[model samples]
Target: MFTLGTYQVHFLTFWCFLKVKRKDRWRNGSKKKFQSQVDRETEFLDVQESDQKLNFKLKGPEGEIQQGTCRYLIGAGGAHSAVRKSLGLKFEGGDYNNEFMLGDVHVKSPQRMKGLHAFFTKEGILAFFPFDDSGNFRVIYGDFKNFDAAKKDLTLEELQFKVDQVGPKGIVLSDPSWLSRFRIHHRMAPCFQMGSIFLAGDAAHIHSPIGGQGMNTGIQDALSLCFKIYLNLRRGAPFELLKGYEQERLPIAKDVLRATDLATQFALSNSLSTRMVKKWLLPFLIEHTPLQKKMAETISQLAISRRDQKIRSNLKIQYP
Candidate 1:
């Protein structure tokens, strides 16, 4: 848990679960105002277009279509957007093959477990985060492919079982607010910009939640693109100026994806080799100040560079 000013903040390292009073969750009226603004700004347009160059028909949700010459397009629909049907963007990546269950529960315990706690069991990774003024806990559990099979609305007995499995037994809960199933995917768009259209956020990259980099990376993507676009618009640059967005962002996304994939693999590994590595080698490395400092620098993102030559050099150092 992290503290800022008068309010206390909790960090759930195991999974992402955030809870606040249903009313106080957002600033007094922020939710309503935000929703109203979203409702007003959102327009679901059905665009149908004939891509004469690709010899394809493009249709949107409402069946409205546009027919025109093909120039350039950017796909920012995110990981869920179908490549073939939507933007014809190729998505190539692997799934984690593990399942994670998360929930929000109200508890009466005085001993609050704060920070990101992980329980590495024979079954999988079970994690918990604390939320709300009433000591509600956000729980994440399971690591096997069958993890979702265990995700039915958890009965009180079932919830107790999970708590017992992850932490010291005898902890009790009074209420559960939310529950859901999730899987990890390590994927990035093969290319960020094809012609004119560019991909950002989940559309450009997807990875395990291990390091909380998903949103950060997406924000970086937005910032990077905004800078480029602003410069291009100010200078009346050609559309090709957008290509640098892809070239610069794609490799960073790929590097993040690779690092996250390794983290997930480490978390899920149970083999004798990994057990030895984790139980012995990992502790030693983490205890060393130099190694720890390097890791800290990497996670802080201060180590990443955007200069083309510097990027190439860092890639060689990290990946090679």
Candidate 2:
């Protein structure tokens, strides 16, 4: 049993088309079916554990229930929308008090550019990610706790005021297609598995989407969980084999949560000292070659290392 929406994807391709194609032709059909049918709103209610199988219920919107039992269960419900208590897993993590506002905006700008622009200012951090189109952009503003207090249906004037509070001059917002407020969080479950039932994606871990890692990490979790299940099915392995998945993946998830938590804090810090550090000191430090290289690697997710490498290398060395 696997909750959907935790599959690995090619970022560039997925962002461009919002679709994922399986690398294996045989798997493509099943993948498409899963993608088409999975419901994000449906919640997993509970998993009843037994000696040889696990029984679970998925509750639909109208109180309808779907009952199922399987030898294995994979919980990929996601970090924010996790059904952990229903699955009998323990979660451990903290929250970042900072809130952020994000939306897509249409702008007529004096400057034409592609790529991401980040503004670190006395008010907060504002970032603009240009879309494939020239006039459309994804804008993000951070550090305003009462962001919700602003106009709910943000008018063009309100949006422009918010943007101007954080950046260079002459940036105007003509129209906004989407807008929403979010709080940053960094947390992970203490365990990713309990017996035959396993947690994946946000259910097991959650972090700030600062480096665009939340979705990516969740997708990787799904891939890893699927691989482990496939191996167990092929080898007729005991459910004990699945425990290794949690042991291996949980630490990595914790690391990601920690890093993203720091990034969120740094992005939203509004204290006078932090403002000075971010606006003035950070850029100066980043100007150094080594610091720039390190920052690049960190944001690119190149710094994470799976314990599998050590396991593989040790096995090879011992065998040789």
Candidate 3:
């Protein structure tokens, strides 16, 4: 992996493959790519929305111009969504000032990195996620004191220097496969839909990677939308039936945005008081059973409550 611009975040320039989270786990082969994963090669030039249909213009893989029209548009195209921009939509959010870095490597230690492991330090926050039992890990670190750290051409040695300061003891990161420098944000679009065109995923909202909520929330956004679209198209439902998409999803997005922004600030805070809170308060809170249960429910989306999507039960897609 190479460097990616701050706006271009999360699975932006990779092999365009990842997993969707289910009740059990998030694991899938390269062939089972997320429907929303857009390989970096594609570019959106412009999008135009209308009463009858939406017109889209884009640059394809081969540097050729392309244009098309569709009756419905769902913008799952990440933060810089073409469809959202075409409609003059506001992606309303602010960026976290701390410069951050991430990469995949193997941690040389016997400790099982089977799940998320966060190391809160005086410098910033270092998080490790295990890929498998072979010690492979995805490491994310925020540099609170070193804002001037190189933004591009990030090296494993640079990462090692920082990891040695903040990472788990006796665990050495090695055989680095990918490294990247990026900034994160806490923001959401003001609305999810306008007319027949709609926005979902990062197109509608984006937040810090603190809770690992980006893809899971976006997938849920698509889920809230897909059946609604089916009802409108296949079951002769009213277009107004689709407005429930925003009603159902906007609150969830708003809540996620608020929660993540707060957590990120708390995690990456440079203030001495906040660092003390992390050092003292957070560890105790982490061990709280109710808090753990709430975090689990929120991560799995079981705690999400829709406002106006009860219509889903009455509406079903009759496959022809």
Clash tally for model 3: 0
Instruction: Order the candidate numbers by TM-score, best to worst.
Output: 3, 2, 1
Estimate the lDDT of model 3: 0.73
Q: lDDT of each structure?
A: 0.60, 0.64, 0.73
Q: Write the per-residue lDDT of candidate 2 for residues 248-279, one digit (tens) a residue.
A: 77777777787787777766766777766765
Q: Which stretches of candidate 2 lie over 4 Å from their true place?
A: 1-30, 33-42, 60-62, 80-82, 144-157, 174-177, 235-241, 287-289, 303-305, 308-320
Sort by lDDT, best first. Answer: 3, 2, 1
lDDT score of residue 307 within candidate 2: 45
RMSD of each: 8.5, 8.6, 7.4
Best by TM-score: 3
**If both were scored by lDDT, which would come out higher, candidate 2 or candidate 3?**
3
What is candidate 1's local distance difference test score? 0.60
Candidate maximizing lDDT: 3
**In candidate 2, how many Å is residue 222 off?**
1.2
lDDT of 3 by residue, 1-320 (tens): 11111111122111122222332243334325554454458787777766687788879899998898888888877998887887788888788778888878878865545555677666677877766666777888987754454556778888888877777556788887778888887778888888877899998998998767888799888877887787778777788878988988889889888888888887777676876676567667766777777776776677776654456555633322
